[model samples]
Target: MRPFLASCLGAACTAALALPPAPAAARPADPSGPVAGPEASRASDLPGGTQSLPLEHLVPAAPGAPAQDMAAPQGGAVHELAPRTVRPFSLVGIVWDDVAVALRGRVQIRTRGRADGRWSGWQDLQNEKSDDAPDPGAAEGLGSAAHGSTAPLWVGASDAVQVRLTLADPHRAALAVPHGLRLELVDPGPDTPAARTAPATTPEATASSAANAPLAPLGATEIPAADQAAAQADVTAAGGAAPAAPVHIGARPRIVTRAGWGADEKLREARFVYTRNVRAVFVHHSATGNNYTCAETPSVIRGLYRYHVKSSHWRDIGYNFLIDKCGSIYEGRAGGVAKPVLGAHTLGFNNDSTGIALLGSFGKTAPPRAALEALGRLTAWKLGLHGADPRGRTAMTSTGGNLYRKGRVVEQHVISGHRDGFKTECPGTLLYADLPSVRQAAARLQGR
Candidate 1:
């Protein structure tokens, strides 16, 4: 009740807020465009190759990165869904300066397809995981006028998705749970018995809550205190922000592995996982860095049976989560996810690929910039939860830098570097030439 900070592994990790409070504002824009219950059809509707990204072209850092100086953003609008249904996604998280915080979870999206059709890959999409957003709403105050909320996460579809939010352990180090998280795609609206109890709050609801990011609560530096009935049932969860951070998954979840083809070769490759729902996101780079984080790190099934039954026979331990230069993000496939699953660590490309391994060797070195700006704001909050489209396309053919040739479609291709979609290099060339400064420092942290 007074800017807390210290709990265990339930959530709200670094708790702190409680200053003067009440003086920030900026929680109004769901004019049905950020993503929620159907409607969204615009963007001309898409079909002839479909390509349009602009959350300010999802930038965060890619040119001399430092988050490219910070400040100068205001571009986020997506609405184009109806690719034939099949959902189980979310990437919601919130965090401002003083109040309003929520971090509903669920982000283990790893579904892949293409095998009898042409040998596909990637799997592990069991129940995904969600159930805790009970109140999560409140903010509008905290230094620099703290007012920034958008941690959305829906996971169904959005032009090749890729999201990673691994921060387990007393909020990982300097503490920062949801400095604002967004990832859209809900649209369940109807009442249906209060949508089966309530939690998706607004922006549409259906399919319980999930974790991995979009966390905004507290009491975890060692246990700050407050179980007042699970923070009063999360105060109607899934909607709130305006504090700093609180992702209390503190030490005790560090065993994650993924290499796949097992389970009897995934039932002989279940006829290519999805068939036609994946679009683009093949980034890679586990170029070997070793492994291990803090807050305990050990839950992806004991880190994938110690990398496939004690280090190599080729089983688990590829890249679904690894980041450790000290920015913390350790959880690699014993599950793997981000919806519509399938990931092995890039080849013909893990069907969709949401892998993230960064232990070291960036072709020699260059890895930590606050752990690449916290993995480029956790990959721009999972490409704003799959509505992916942060604009980035410019090449009239006149001497260049990124090359840009293959098909050429822009609107949602961000914070990439694993040699920008396979060729072997892996996050090399000093981290794939610093993916345009970490995708423009995570699209200026959501102003793209």
Candidate 2:
């Protein structure tokens, strides 16, 4: 059984203990980050038809761990390996960065035992906020720090894993995806079996229910399966691993939203829709404590928009995508989000920004760990397909359109936040602090 984390209010984490705490873990007051903990996000099917690491749903183990040897990475990496029995199993890996002494990121430990080909799933060892993702404390800023992280993962033998990581500096990407840290396979302790492992999954009932409910396709036509290949071709030509850049991506390839003609759904602090052809991503936080499941998000969005558009008199939902406290990504604001038009969310940077509204104001909230990883995976996939450089200073600079900051407006082609081009905390202050990590992650996947 997996562990279900309950203490996480937004992004709070409760780390488990081990013998002689690692040097970094012993460091006091990471006011900006969550300490490491014991967790296993099994990849088997769970309840939501999608998979989220069920925190607190742990299978209790015996005390008294095994003897082990720690293999440290050459650089600022904390690499350690132990047999499932020899060491008290928990998530493990290296700390990437700690800007402002609060904001931190890491190229986490992945794969319980990969080099030796033990059957363990890839485990991201990012010390994430216990609730959603990178739940930055008050000392911690926001953005990726609030929702994303670079912690390593812990897995057993007999699993194959792919490690994905992002760096804190725009200049240097995490070595995890490439070679930030290395893994050494050890014998599974005397107790656990070395069977193969996969990532977690959502419940079928919930997944089916969400699918049956039937929401409208984002404002654009669904990229047909045949065209999916074409879309890939276009992306490859644009400067990805191939040559094309993938400029578009639909949400959760597993679930398909059909196109419909109707009014938008009501959301929790805003009225919104998820349609159109959005081009770039502008990230934000919801700052709420409620945890959300993917199946329950449509109604949440519906109620939110009712407040924002109708109650607040906004044109549409401020964000195009709402990442819930449980790490689910919901659609918002249809017209501009679906299209590449500028938005009201960012100042002087809406023209091409596709605002992804995280379900809480990160300055005060923590998102789910799944949410952060999902964002990383999604962002990487999207940017890779589009050939957009998350950290690249250069842009097409040819978008001749009206952009705006605080609704004042301007024209731009880069993907940025409200603070970058404007003078307001539209995306919140903490989010700006982690943009570098976000962009760096995206840059690595640009045009895949």
Candidate 3:
């Protein structure tokens, strides 16, 4: 029975593991720049019911005054009622064209609803926080750092919108506004109730459950390779003691897929599936605020989804899975949760691994115990599938980065924090300090 199972599953798994990781140059450049004043610079009909509206129609350089300095005007600037026809957009984000220019100010957005002509209250969009790690595929002279606009804010369903930017220091007004401001409108796909139900089982979590039997206990006696021939002969002659129930290393936990959180499927571009053997799990904190309740998680996810896709212009969410402070896990990126879907979370080493980001920033505060436990359960389940030891050290080849030069081999914990691979304070100082405990808990779950 052991030989039969091995023959059935080994080949596929071997091929997957032997495959080489893709080069860093393969990642696409982030789309930046938005037209601050209406007139829409260029209207692009994008995939997934998303539209890109560039600020082509800028406040025309005052009747030909050499393009009005492209730099942001001094003091507070308000663009009331964007100069575009109202459309049915459920999500919105700000984008820019330059990578070097950093905007410093408070950005507030308010949208007009079609139903009652009422405008939504001003919503604060988070400014772009410094990510110590450089972006993958950064061009010459462009450091690995991620340079873009602030994270998006959820505005529910709306037609019209307005935005205001107030510079913190008027002295910095000399800095240009980058190329322009772009507003992305995303249409949440069909609201089909039937398609929104929670999945009873996911690929990884259900692997053991669906078999309807406890796995063979670990440490079961193993026959030497030289004795396998005789063992197989015996198994063929007599159905060999029904392969002592396969070892059950760890149990999978309940997870919420992007769909489970009512994600707008149309916001992200078509799924980009890249397969790799799960060698390590990198932990990270979303670096967003923590003043949210469990009920508002879905809303928070929507905002993040829009930001990652529309604003950052990535293929999908940077993390493979997101865990809220309440311990709820939500699937990220548009691929099978069980697969080693490469993420953009860790700049230099995103291949052959998985990224799990806690939903809130933990720079000063420690992560909740519940969140830590969920992290353990998740890594235990994910890594166990690939026969990886969570507490062990492993080596991964860096695709490239500022922290570790391209093609260099780097060692990491089976369960590590984002800072382990890059020079960033990601995963936060407090949360990163807790990784040792996380590794221990995961190993315990794996019965290591």
Candidate 4:
């Protein structure tokens, strides 16, 4: 019992570390489409109950017109897919081939509501602030990194969709047409009315209750064999057994699995890929807006999963886990929640880390205390499994990016905000500011 107590409790700790930080903002209004036309014919099956239609395959608005480059197409390309009905799909999004090409323009979309049979007003898709690496705009074949996309916008219960791309600022644009454009339709499965009436519990309440359990004071990030040896020595020094070294049990939060959220696992193209040791955890905010209830969170996650895998073309959901404003922890990606599942959340460093995303945009509002505490508890358990101290720093070689060029060796905290690795206000300013406290709380959980 003493040895078990020390191995688990001596394994978690933390410290403070700082690192670097994207810009792009232009709002588009409800730009209506010409008409509700037929759905495009170039549809490809994607892993999760979704389909992708390439812009290149879409015929021009007027017959006989040559295909235009998406960036600066003549008079701004306004192509629409012929309208075709399908099973009630609930989400739509745009996918592009290049991440580096910053278009000085707006991309808008509209969907035919399944219930009304009427097309919704044109809605803009965000082109800036991508969470994945850049895609090469190649002609022959897409490069390994040549897939990027916008955050999927929720369009409730839709059956048809149409899209248009326009260069708002023609002069300063990259002067290149978008090599490829794709639209995706995702079905989040039939609504689970029961989800609305489900009971809510403090996700970390069980862990918090055992907060007073005893633990070895572990200040260092590394919990080597010497610590265990010392614990045994302490027991010997205290008569027969050191009062059973009160075992400090760290409880895991009640995580909602992908199935619990009604995810169509078959839609995923392949099984999850695992990485080696998880050296760090990157915290991020979805930046997808904060207008949602705890009940609507699963729907939001399903949309993001479709956006990431189907539209963005990533291997899986970028984060290993997700947290809602209500402090619920969700097992993100399909891999075993306990494994070192590589995630695509932080660019250039996805292989050695795990990403924990808070489910809403936190740029303006401070993250809920519950959400922050959930993060702390999450890191405590995750990092502890790897014998890492949450308060300490570790080195990782960046594949390269705007902040740290490729092949750069950067030292980051075991628990880091997304900005620490990439140049983005990712976890949000208010949330980034809360990271220090998160590290401290995690350390305390480890008895550091």
Candidate 5:
């Protein structure tokens, strides 16, 4: 039998580490002029903010002409904006007032690069309503703020944009566009000097630092790895109770804390939610595109956070953790990294699972070897914490989704792709194809 380590209270574990506090002013607040409203104030406090503009209907094309023939759409009920300049932004998405309504059509966008001053070809924004979301009726899923949205696309640094939305079947009266449609342009903000040079000392940063404990010093950017024996001993030292059955646990791997990437604590809802245990790990790719340098990763992550909370009205960021193309892992959400924090990631399956999103679109491009290795190490350690076998399968109850109905228990891989639980192409095709190897590697890391 695989040896198992006991679990402990997050506070107790953190106290046991007892590291020194970090510098108080590691990340200074934004210096931009103040804005209006609670939401706008929150945005101004962060390094970057979002710009929302309503989409307008365009006149129909000439009779019997193809929709593609005109500069814009040539047919029925099209909503779009002609090319226009806007403030600097690195990410973009479309959102509507109602969460229940789905966009039954194609959504495309083109942008002018901020640096090069060149316009890029139009790209499709995946309709993410059916896949990426909190479970139905959950607190995050309910409310005036929660809205239907397209998958966010990372457009790099762009100063101008154009958007087009069209129904799949223009002639069908039943297929109409959703109401309150608007475009959200998100600027992740520039990497601040303090964030890049100093250690974080905020309460949230301290909590995150404490979660990693002895594996990483307080305010350290990355947690260092430990051997299996040392890792188990560290858990025991942290007062983890002994488990009844033997459980296999893997060596802990290095992980970047939220503070490491400079997350503004004031942005997300203060309260943290917990689950019973983590039974599975759902993998995803931030459909945000791959046009980024490793140095720009922190800004990209910050942009995603703002988009999720400020734009989509989620209580917090969706994924439990985010991995960069270079394989550096950043803690996602606000709860302790080791705890079973409920995240608004995979629809219908957020109950007993953890979500890990890779930081770029992967439909055609393959994830780097370092990223895949990091995935293996992270899964092995995290799943091992809960006695879950990385290569084994687990049955998770679905709340409600395109693939499974509410209350249905579905058996799935302990490590699964986003598409496995929903009817959408997430984590992309190429990355999805690599899960088997990742599973195998994780299992080996556990000494199984």
Candidate 6:
């Protein structure tokens, strides 16, 4: 058994090590028209989209105040947009032109619900630094089109929005507000055709599904689960060589492929990147708020996909996988689910890890039990594939981040929270605290 585990791990690492990381800056531009796939239909046909509006200096309410209050006693200024009616949107975030610059300020927003027509209180948007980004100097981090962005907040269906940005103390001038600031309103789009009805098959979807071939039928919305023995056989059938001895692997969990979430194949770069091995799993909360239903999960994912690729200018959606509150796991980035697909998530730790994002903000609210269970099941199967122990620790080299310097080899849990890799309140305090139980669940699932 030990020999098989060693062989399995060695094989996985060898396969991925041969493929060097692709430079993000060199990625081909998104195709302007529908791609060649059956799913390569017009972008307009896609349900969700993002609206970006520049924020202007806000006028002071008090008389004789500095125009736009650029130089207040506090030494900082405020930029905002007064409430105005607009198309329906469910999520919002702030983006700046420079990916290298961080937003050193507070972002608050209020929205008028489309159904009730009532204004909600100002909600603070989490300012995520490079915590949710690719490592500096990495191919995924070198993209010229990438933008600095705040964590997106989900506000449900809203027609009117007002945003305010308050820069921090002026004494620290170097940490001033970032340039080219804009407010992004995202409409997850209608849930009907995008989620309920199947669109015409596209070559992209077929290819993506084929990556999980034999485990699930072609064009399958969700990959069906398999027992441990069946899963081991499936891995071998899917091109993974069998080990010398029997490898300890968990049962494969059901996962919704990218096609199941209606990802427009034309929206992302065509090339996929690879990493050596998935040494750890980083958990995160979408921070897009918790106002969605299970049925709306696909639309919400679609909204995030557009925002990540179009608004934030990434190669694709950052997380490797996303889980809904209902415990349904959805494939995020376009790469094959079982492959060591490098994700633009968890800053310095992205190279040898997989990221699983829970679909709603879990800061104040507790995450649903189903979601935690899904997390455990996911980590059990994925980590088991690479011969990682969910309850164990591994040394991971930090490329660069607030918590560690480049080349720092830090010992981390096999299942870790995003905050563990970077300095940010990600996965939220409540969810972060529940990681102990998740590790235990995953370890048990792996028969450890």
Residue 126 lDDT (model 1): 16
Q: What is the TM-score of each candidate against the true structure?
A: 0.21, 0.38, 0.59, 0.65, 0.82, 0.83
Query: What C-alpha lDDT, on a 0 to 100 scale, does residue 256 get in candidate 6?
Result: 89
Which stretches of candidate 5 lie above 4 Å from their native place? 1-43, 57-79, 141-145, 171-175, 195-202, 233-247
Per-model lDDT? 0.31, 0.34, 0.57, 0.59, 0.74, 0.74
List all candidate RMSDs to the true structure: 25.9, 17.4, 17.2, 16.4, 14.8, 14.5
Cα deviation of 263, candidate 4, in Å: 3.3
> Compared with the true structure, what per-residue lDDT tens digits does model 5 show for residues 1-448?
0010012112334322122221222111220111111111224655678988665422222234333433344443444454556777889998877777877777788787878777777788888674578888777732445778888888888877766666545433133456677789998766876854243556755665676655667777666777776656443323356555545777887777777787776667766788888899999998888888888888888888888887788978899999988888888987777778899889999998999999888999999888899899889888887778999999999999989999999998999999999988998999999999999999999889
Residue 18's lDDT within candidate 1 is 14
After superposing all C-alphas onto the true structure, candidate 2 shows an RMSD in angstroms of: 17.4
Q: Lowest-scoring 10 consecutive residues by lDDT in candidate 2?
A: 192-201
**Clashes, model 1:** 119
Q: Which ten residues in a row have the lowest lDDT in candidate 5?
A: 1-10
Candidate 1 vs 6: which has more lDDT: 6
Q: Which stretches of candidate 4 lie over 4 Å from their true place?
A: 1-35, 40-48, 51-89, 98-126, 133-146, 158-168, 171-177, 193-250, 269-271
For candidate 6, give the lDDT of residue 424: 94
Whole-model lDDT, model 1: 0.31
After superposition, which runs of candidate 6 have C-alpha atoms over 4 Å from their true positions? 1-46, 61-79, 141-143, 170-175, 194-200, 237-239
Cα lDDT tens digits, model 2, 209-263, are 2322222222322222222334455343222354443353322222122111112
Q: lDDT score of model 4?
A: 0.59
- What range of 10 consecutive residues in model 3 has the weakest lDDT sum? 217-226
